[model samples]
Target: MRPLTNTPTRYSWATILLHWLIALIFIGQLVLGFVMVRIESQRAAFELIQLHKSFGFLLLGLIILRIAWRLGNKAPPLPPSVGALERRTAPLAHLALYAFQLALPLSGWALVSVSTLEIPSMPFNLFVMPNLPLIESDAAEGFWAAVHWYLAYAGAALVALHVAAALRHHFLLRDQVLTRMITPSSAGE
Candidate 1:
């Protein structure tokens, strides 16, 4: 069975769970974001927006925990099949991924916080999430909205690149890079 902590060659169960959960939700958010804007009914769009916001907040929380877990656990070394250039750049790419993952949700939150409409964000109909301390104005809203939109698309592109790299490592290079994330290492295996 997969242990709770990482092994030399594979991720811990916690890390695998967090990684897949974040990926699934982030992909769903991307789809939801694209579709919500095109909805003809304002009520339907509003509902979808609320749901997106709720998930965004949830993503932010999970990201924070993931970051903490990552910091506490060192990732396994890249397989020897990985080139030197890739070895150097992989960490940079990961940093960018983490940055976008963090910034997208924050920009969305900021966008709503500064909206002229002043609609309160009630996440999942559970409770109202307080807006960030920023001056509410149309200009601020526009700025944040642009930031959020750009970040979302850019983040999506980064995610695609990340997936491509992982696939290359798994199929092209025929390495354990991808499988390590999918399955935990067993002792003496």
Candidate 2:
């Protein structure tokens, strides 16, 4: 069977590496995020939460680099089998991720930075997370906290859709659709 897109030209090796790394970080974020919301805002829990936030911020940096790389490098075109609906949706999906990956952390940063939770953050006494420097009022912090959680929920939903689609392409479609992104380098894939 023929591939849907042209020989994958969209992602460079560096892009592929960062994509997978981001995926892992996002999965970790999901786990820790659940804990942060459901569990009490205890110091121990805060430690774990800080780990997630730190990694997410790292992802933030990488996502920016990935965007820069994508800007510079041509991505592999979608396979021919990819339908028009998918063609339209996929780009939006990627863009949504780019937006969320940044917004999610920044929102969280604002939340923790502003909230009076008094959690000991950052690992191994390395550094204290600098606050956003808000007024000692509840309304503002509460607003951003709500925004942070709401966005986290939205980002979670997007991840679910993203994974389900990948599985659909891999197992159901039985095409190189997933491989188009998973493949190591442009030349090899």
Candidate 3:
């Protein structure tokens, strides 16, 4: 059985779980966001938008926990096959991912908060989530909406690059970069 914490060569089960869960939800949010805007039915679009907001809040919470966990735990090192330049840039790339992951949802939250419609965000109908204490006006709403839209697209591009890098490490480099994330480290065994 794999350990709950990170191993020298493998990720902890918790890390693996959070990684995939966030990835899936983020991807779903992107798809839902695009489709919801283009929806012809007002009711359908509103429903989807609510769902998207709920998922965004959920993502926000999970990411907070993920960041906490990551800070507490040390990551496994890259294999020797990786070049020095890649090694240097990998941390920056990861930092960018973390930043985007945090920023995208916050932007969405800001967008909803400043919306002139004054819609209350009830995440999964659990409770009414309060909006950020930002001024509410059409201009504020439009600004945040633009920020959210641009961030979403930019974050998607970063995610694509991240995936390509992982695939390159796995297929071309023939290294354990991807597998370590997929499975537990075999350091002890």
Candidate 4:
């Protein structure tokens, strides 16, 4: 079996898998969020919203695992070709990505908790997930809903920036930044 740990020159298979999975799911969740909001029928909208909530909870778990894995493994170093400014900023950018990965779901969960509707989230329809113990208030619900919405947009922007940076590293800089994540070499640097 392939080792699941990262090396100095390339990310482990685990990291690669988690990264892509989160990216795909996040994109799908964004599309679902927009589509569900536009759903005209109340029943259809409720079902879609429930699905969205399930996926959001799933994302929360995946991200928590990813973060734990990342902390335990030493990530590959930035290529020597990378600039000083980029090197300094890259960690901050990553921190922001992790922050959003966490914040978005928690905010959504909180929003559901304080909502007057009081819908229970069943992740993947496996079982009922308890809501956060937040006081039921219209004002609180609105606040968390707004927070969730804004955070989603902000996270989307960060993802776009991340993709642009990766493309720049791949096409413009001709570096290993993008390749390392996609297809890490077995040979050590």
- Root-mean-square deviation of each candidate, in angstroms? 1.0, 4.4, 1.0, 1.2
Give the 10-residue window scoring lowest on summed lDDT in candidate 1: 180-189
Clashing pairs in 1: none
Candidate 3 residue lDDT tens string, 74-182: 9989998999999999999988988888999999999999998999999999999999999999999889899999989998999999999999989898999999999
Residues 1-189 of candidate 4: C-alpha lDDT, one tens digit per residue:
446798888888889999999999988999999899998999999999999999999999999999999999988899999999999999999999999999999999999999898777888899999989999899999899899999999999999999999999999999999999998546444
Worst 10 residues of 3 by lDDT: 180-189
Model 1 misplacement above 4 A: 187-189
TM-score of 3: 0.98
Candidate 3 or 2, higher TM-score: 3
Off by over 4 Å in 2: 1-10, 39-41, 117-125, 133-136, 186-189
**lDDT score of residue 145 within candidate 3:** 90
Q: What is the per-residue lDDT of model 1 for residues 1-189, given as tens digits with 9 covering 90 to 100?
A: 657778778888899999999999999999999999999999999999999999999999999999999999989889888889999999999899889999999999999998989888998999999999999998998899899999999999999999998898888889999999998766643
Q: By the TM-score metric, which is better: model 3 or model 4?
A: 3
Per-residue lDDT of 53-96 in model 2, one digit per residue for the tens? 67766777888887887776667677788899999999999899
Task: Find the number of clashing residue pairs for candidate 2.
Answer: 12
